[model samples]
Target: MAKKANWKELMTLHLRAYIPALVAFLFLLPSPVFAAALSLSPTNASVRVGSTVTETVFVLSTDQAMNAISGTISFPPELLQVVSVSKAGSVLSLWVQDPTFSNADGTISFSGIVPNPGYTGSHGLTISIQFRGKRAGTAAISFSPSSQVLANDGNGTDILNDTNSATITVTSSASAPSTPPAPSTAEQGLLARIISSTHPDQTQWYNRPHAIFDWTNAQGVSGVRLGYDKDADGEPSVPYSEPLSHKELDLEDGIWYFHVQEKGSGGWGPISSYRVQIDTVPPLPSTVTFPQGTTTPSGSSITALFTTTDELSGIDHYQVAVDGKVFTVTADAGSRPYQVSAGPGAHMLLVQTYDKAGNFSTANGRFFVTGEASSFFDFFSFGWLAVNYISIFLIAFAILVTLLFAAWYIRTHFMAYRYRLNRQLGLTHAHVHKEFDTLKEAITEELLALEQTKSKRSLTREEERLIVRFKKLLDHAEQTIEKEIEDIQR
Candidate 1:
């Protein structure tokens, strides 16, 4: 018991570590894992050679909430030719791969997932097939033994069970309508399937009130009785005479079912139903937002969350636009944060989400992008890098100051040099030699006058002192002028 307990404890710890990964893995699963019975409607039927017949494939019964389903229906290519396949009123919310068929392979294949709360019903339609009879023979339609179903059963378990197949007996006038023979109740369950043309896709919500339903009227079939209502088991009450192959209705905005029956000489046949979903109103107005607030750090991308809801048909796709330019249209990112690529600036983000019915709602918000410049290139786009804003501003300020100081110093030195050149050339300065010569002659004459005055009157003490200062000044002036002239010439 201790060993067993320890083993369970270890497993619990392991699961705890992987819980997130497991949840993600299960959420994306496209096949149901619950044990469910799969069956083809009208399990047995007879078709005239060269004529077409319709069959529906759906989940017959399941006790668990199955989230995903996948299957392949195989038929004998020699006896039956593939006509078409439709998933109009299917229970699948998302198709991993759309239903497709190949006549050469005699197979119809589909893989899809249902939303959470999965699907629990007797008749969860998966897909419908139309096959044409080629010759007189028995063509058996059966699900491949390896069909799959997935469920949210606390574990990612995949469970599949045996299938209830259909037997198609193609004949050559063996049971002609002119001399009709009674068929087994199963073979005559529904002679044909109901199909819509004006509202072809049952999964899509449409605004058009006008609808047209068409069906194949088997041989000897006279009138058709049909009923339009919201009830699933709605019976056919209105009757039209023979040769009627279609019916038309102008319906209101709601889910509607068209029940149809055909009457030959033997009385009313079994009824079949077709679904028509109508939604004229658009998705409720909602917003798309950036989780990191409206303003984001300048980066390569920003994530947007769309909060648009549709109660009737559900949300389908989302389109994102930045600064009036459409960026991306996505179906996967509708429920999650969608990443948007934009340059740093004030940006207008316009987001639009569409419902499965083609109705859309729009919301927009404004945001700014900024950051430290990554490199020299960032200087041009200044705030788009991952650097500190204060630091970037300070660095830019210092660079501007340095550039201005350098320019000032260069201008100052150039002006000083030009002043010296002008002094010698005399364009913007006093001519050094000419002015010096004038000053020298005046000084020499003044000195002579001072000496003469001194000799004339033994000179007053002031006169003697003046003569001495004049001689010294003239001598100093001569030496300074000579040096400047020599330097300018050099």
Candidate 2:
């Protein structure tokens, strides 16, 4: 009985080993009938804007049961925006390369929710160890196969392994710009002109509620667009009108340019351009009121006065000068007339007033400063007195002589100018000589024409005076020419 039992156990072991070997041969042998394969489902998955999408990566094999198989999906951050990741099952592990897959760990991982929520389309995560979703735009996520269970036949011979890959695309959700209707061109006979209250040029200051520019046209204007600019090249300020009109527009003081677009049934005509420059700077104080050549002392104080006003900024400060030196007034006195001090001897006293905006005006005048009494040597000697008297007379005489010479030179030069002008205008030299025959003739003809004519129906006095003065000027020229001819003959 023992011998029989041993033989039976041996026979059973042999049978077991032989049967597995036969199965292995059937699987591992070179047979055209059998093959191994692996693949993924939904290779190109897409998700809607602001939504989540889940896809299963299959490790499909011809064999019913395979072991030790793992897979991973990597997402490109540039392509898809990742929010979070989740993992499930002991067999699967999750890692994220914020680029392709979504997990806290910075690695290409699988077995978890990839790319946090709110990420959009085609997160094409490249094949890299550590992934940072740094790149953006249309991207893709590559699903790659990880090692799986190795399969063997009954004879312990390895049969095959499983592998697969896939890619997904993400789409964008931005909109496009509005399309404008096709533009048509036609002449609408529309005309625009600007009228102003102060300056017809419409670019200066005069009074409040100052009118700058106004336009009129024959045809009724339906709509208009108004555009303005400050600097020459910068983008224009935001356009002020959709349908512009004659409504009042308040403007500040500076260079300004304007353009208007008129709309009608015949389409919009070429834009009309107009400009206005408003200045609120108050005019400088007038009537500087200087004395007739007052002498300034060597170091004495001199004072001058002037009134000032500002339409916008109030007067801020004032300065007084003697030939532009020596401080005069240094205290603030509001809008009152201020005084400045200067040194003596025909000193030029100027009062410069400044507005809050740094606009300035100047008033010029003169002052005298006498030295302290009895500060000189020898008061009552005839010799000294005579010499002083002679010096005074000589100075006065020199000044008078200078004045006479200057007057003569000026008169002669002016006659020359008149002669030249008459000749250029095709008038005779004799006509030019009559204009400068005397001081009164010269003044009435050249300087006092407008004054003399202000009350007359026309410029009769001015015209008559100028004609006679011109004839005198021509006579002088003729005489000069005749003298030169006589010299040549001699």
- Per-prediction RMSD in angstroms? 22.4, 44.0
Candidate 1: misplaced stretches above 4 Å? 1-190, 203-207, 300-303, 324-332, 371-490
**In angstroms, how far off is 416's CA in candidate 1?**
49
Residue-by-residue lDDT tens digits, candidate 2, 1-490: 9999999999999999999999988888775432233344455554434333443444333432322223455555544544323222222222321223445432344322222221122221222221122332344555444423233232322223543444444434332222234344344354345455444554333333354455664365676656655322123233432444553567665444566666666756555655554445644474455332355455544334465444333455776566657453432552344444443344566677766445677777656665634434535455698899999999999999999999999999999987776555444334444543554366546545565565675666766676677668766766786575445434
- How does candidate 2 score on lDDT? 0.48
State TM-scores per candidate. Answer: 0.38, 0.24
Model 1 is weakest, by summed lDDT over 10 consecutive residues, at: 424-433
Q: Model 2: how far is 276 from its true place, Å?
A: 1.2
Clash totals for all candidate models: 9, 57
Local distance difference test, each candidate: 0.77, 0.48
Model 2: residue 125 alpha-carbon error in angstroms: 47
